[model samples]
Target: MSEVLESTTTELTPGVRVPLIGLGTWPMAGEEAAAAVSRAIANGYRHIDTAENYGNEEDVGEGIRRSGIARQDIFITTKFNRDWHSREGVLTAFERSAHRLGVDYLDLFLVHWPNPAQGRFVEACEGLRQLADDGAIRAWGVSNFKPAHLRHVLDAGLTVPVNQVQVDPARGQPDQLAFHRQHGITTGAYSPLGRNGDFMASPAITGPARELGRTPGQIVLRWHVQQGRIATPKSASDARQRQNLDVFGFELTQEQLAAINALETGGPPRLDSDTFGH
Candidate 1:
């Protein structure tokens, strides 16, 4: 059995300590998803990220069971769809997701998208708060929320623990990250590595990879955790899974970090939450 890596965590709430790095399960389903989760756990990962929209919660749950790790030993995060953007609807979504994941409670639950057109995300946030207050979940957050959406949530006097977004070296979302910091909201990065291997070829990333003798992906994940952000990087290959978790052992120089940070293209994120929804 592989030794489990010691977790480095960031506080999402007063008492909630979320691992700095996690496993992302998206665009994978069925037995393949299950096996990946199982392999990840055996290789030292304690964080697993999934969503209802991904349609693989059952498989992820099966993988957890196969790993023989106690439920409490792992941190699980899942997101709900827009159709459930209501006080009661969010509760219903939680019930269904918990049932599918075979877990009595969740570590963190996020409103998948704002779906601002529906005008009920606030109520959905209300539902999430109730769940968190009642111990149904450790914490609740939003995904794909722009500054405007988060501002609305805050204006309502609601506190957001985290905001999950697509962030990579190529599209760093500096403005979004700055807002999160100002609001004391933890930034959870999805797709932390840019869409393809193309971005990894940049000298900014490659230089560090070569100097440290680590793969470009490892360098990137290291850059993420070094900044105190939470990243969920998905990989089904056992070797990749192990490699992802192995990022904790090294440090990146400020110059190298800045070089990679400079890779941001200043382009709009791939999906605009304003007009996009499940």
Candidate 2:
């Protein structure tokens, strides 16, 4: 399986594209992260999304090296940890990630969260800008950012081309998606399947899964891709990883798409950025 040819991509900028589907490695580390990444790569995954908070950068890098693919042939994205959200903190944190990943350059770097209470995310992105200019990073973005947070990044003079956030069956985030469209940023969904095992039980998702001859998860994942959002679903299993990437052969009807989207009930309030994290 040549994942390079089998996968599709979303444009992050002119001439720069990240795979529409990427292998997400969270809640995984050490040997576990290494095994999953190497297997995903061998089974046809060219893009991998990791984070400093995940504590598995070295494992991810080792997995990449084990895949026998050149660094340029793969698209890797990792985020700066929340502890290092300052301008200088970003540079130092990035250095740690790069060193751990054993790569001289990162395909994409993101501020892991917009902890507005900390008040340094804007400067973090500005530091990422300098990194991009210095050729230390290819592109930069933010994760878990809300509309107001995006404005801060933009106001700080950063033109981030991507924003990684939670957009699943139950968290469509229409307003945030609209904001992304208005500002020319692409939305990258962290979990295509809704949380709390709600993904499997949702008729909105399963109905389409049966009719379309795909898994419920596939229906939800495809929905995100069809709507032009980069969907990164995490699984430690190689089979599941490949299944997540194999959704281009079919699409959901507009009605099916809308129905699944209607499952959105504003998501859990805990996940809301206002009370999320510090």
Candidate 3:
């Protein structure tokens, strides 16, 4: 309901700007996915995150068409599936995604996973660089990568503009975040609300939510934005999507932020390649 959430953007890297709070379209697809995206945009979401594996790019594109927002106004992102790491596979995969999304160029493109077992990371990174050179994607990044993997990209001379990972009130990634900040790389959080239940139930989030007179989701998202990381929350429900974007009106005091930061116990990350069969 706050207007602030509807109108905020963050410069992730030079020439790369994204809505600080975005709608994540993971499991939703088809007409349902399209409708949800359209509704979210109408309600004031300017960034949308999707992946080829999600099977919803076309639907997302349809929604964008319906939203009446200019193509230049929305920051759209999609990813290259790990299985498509071969040189040819990467190009073909992204082209397919772009075609389905009905967009000539993506605001950002990412390597979905490291897939070290496949031994195609360098090749994939090269392919991404080629795409960038050709202007097929405005920016390139990765998801679920550790410091070492990121360093490999850097050493290889691939300037990754952003890295999307899972960060929330319960699972804070301090070391990874510090590494990114040192390198001038932006971080994007996928489950910014800690997959919903965990975030809503955490004392770290609840205490702040109650003290600030805001929802736990808002508190968690504000934490990410205040930390300078981009946060994308997934929800098909219109009201919930709007609530996820309502993070800009309040400011977490330094003490409140520290309280949340202190909750970071260097806990185990909830996401791993094993879980996703990468």
Candidate 4:
């Protein structure tokens, strides 16, 4: 069945709006990844997320072509590693990624992580800002960045249009979310559903799933977008991909929303940005 799900967007700039739900391509490679991307675009997904670290930009580009969707109609996002954390290094990285993706311009490009120990993150942000101003990219951001790291970037007078972090009902980073709110940075939730189905059994999620007649995954993804946050959920199955993007047609009650928020266990994320980055 061919179905076009309505897309919802969050504005990162005056005119740039990112689709709230995106297809995340990670750990999937070669033709399988390409096929998945093609299927997702056909299923009404306008946003696609990839990273150099994922080693699938070439496949992703192939998938885009296979989808037969106009390049301008899709919002493509990709990230670079710490090695590209400099003014010139960032440009080089963008060129390489764009070339691999077979696109001359990108919708959004990001620093995959803040390698603070290297102390070049500030310069990296500078490079991203320059790219945005010159129209090489529509917008730029950082991922896995904590409040402390963001403060330094902010102090350096750089504009962070978005910050993609690991956020889910189980590991809700209230402090990090608050910091983003204070600084006007849009929160993009990677691993937004948590590891596996571990958190799906919580009453906070299951209760709403039962009440709303939706899957636990849908419940959690709805929670993210209802709060004006963006979520990129990875699913290779056609059925699962459709389910993930079919979150916009319903509304969750205040009680249900608060119940899900109450599931926070106050634990550290599986991957801490401080010590881990490529």
Candidate 5:
């Protein structure tokens, strides 16, 4: 039988379709990050997610340029840092990000975190609106945002295209997912594979991996896909990078999916929403 890599996509904004699976460049920098990105694109990933804070935008840009993929064929996402949440600061930060990425426009630009305490989210969002109006970014959204914060933004009449949050079998975000669904906003899962060092050792993952003849990593990835959330898994190893995107060829049975979902504890998020001083 031939292996089939399933391709899924969700539209966070009109005319902006981001692939369900993409490469996340976090904690990766320098030449290694660039080479990993190049390998991922060569291995069939069309979407790439990076952030100004990642400090790898230049390397990512180099990788994309070397991938031989047309700029239009790739969906690039970058974020505005927390410190740069002010109105004037946002434009300057975005311009710097674009310059580093070597791109005139970003497919999706997001607010890295909601620092409401700074009392600048509203103004920052307004800056994003201006960028959208100027055609500098094709779409704009937020990451690590809670429902209350999202409501505040919406109440301000700012339409967010998507909300990128931490979602995985171990940390199911049903409320966040529902909120996005209710508001016509797409949800992106940043760490679909629970950062648990022993994620594969868990019965929740291993059991399904056994049934599907796949690795626990693949099982976790498929679970994210089966749940209909966009996921970006990060890896520096070429083998792991390939394994991360190798999720397309198999289908997890409903029973297997339920087994994985049953592992949800609604526990603390893997990423720190409060660390950014929001």
Candidate 6:
């Protein structure tokens, strides 16, 4: 069963392929988080996302070790927060994340959020590029960055390969996705399920789930994959983790996809990089 229902992958760069469905390790920590990682790997997830703010890097590392999978066989992504937005601070914080994750080279590293108010994200992008060049990280990207932030990075003469952010059926980010496509940046979604319980009640999501004999969460994730974004939906529950990873088996039709797209309400307490935080 595992052999037939394997996970799909996306290549961010030459020789760097990440599984499209990753186990997002946020708000999960300690031994509990470690167990989820191990379960995810055993269930066939090769990509895992972590962050300095998540405070679960060590546990994620422990899970990898427990899985008995070679470190090279897994793709690890860890992010640094705004506190490390400075040029020097970037590398320093990266080293700390690496040390905690117990790895020397990361498959993906990102600036967790664009600290627009600080005005030093460009420097952080350079720092990530240096880390990639130095063989410390295989690929580098940014998260939660708007078009302006992306443009700022590009104007500095660098075009990143990936941008992870909060994208779901509700907040599809159509304009931002178009901008990323024009620039050749792959968009990765964070809150791909748009929260949890209250989110699943939407008729747009439930209708597809019932018709396809899949869970609403699976329907949503399939939507992300079909539209060509790396979807990282976090779940500490082993059952839910495997359930989310099992989305590759089905495909959504054009009309069905459009129906789901029509569910966007445009109100979710937006977090704009331009005026969010420093």
Q: Model 3, range 187-271, lDDT digits (tens) per residue? A: 9998777754454676777888888788877888888888778888888888888888888777888987888877676776785
Alpha-carbon RMSD to native, per candidate: 2.6, 2.5, 2.9, 2.8, 2.9, 2.6
Model 4, 1-278: lDDT tens digits are: 11222248888987888899999999899999999999999999999999999999999999999999999999999999988999999999999999999999999999998988998998999999999999999999999999999999999988788999999998999999999999999999999898784779988888889988999999999999989899999988999999999998888999989998888888877888898988
The local distance difference test score of model 3 is 0.83
Show the colliding residue pairs in model 3: none
Write down the TM-score of every candidate: 0.97, 0.93, 0.91, 0.97, 0.91, 0.93
Clashes of 6: 0
Question: lDDT tens string, model 2, 1-278?
Answer: 35444347877866678888899998899888999989998888889999988889999999999889889989999998778877788889889999999999999999887888888788888888888888898888888889899998888667879998888877778888999999999999996675565656878888888888898888888899988898888888978987898898897889988898787777542377754653
Model 6 lDDT per residue over 1-278, tens place = 24332347777888787788999988989998999999999988889999988989999999999999999999998899888887788789878998998888899999988888888999999999988888889999999888989999999999798999888877877888899999999989987888753657778778889989999999999999888789888887878988999998888889889988877666542687677753
lDDT of each: 0.92, 0.85, 0.83, 0.92, 0.84, 0.87
Given candidate 5, what's the lDDT at residue 36?
Answer: 84
Error of 6 at 187 (Å): 0.6
Pairs with backbone N, CA or C atoms under 3 Å apart (clashes), candidate 1: none
Worst 10 residues of 6 by lDDT: 1-10
Error of 3 at 132 (Å): 1.5
Task: Note the clash tally of each candidate.
Answer: 0, 0, 0, 0, 3, 0
Positional deviation of residue 7's Cα in model 2 after best superposition, in angstroms: 7.5
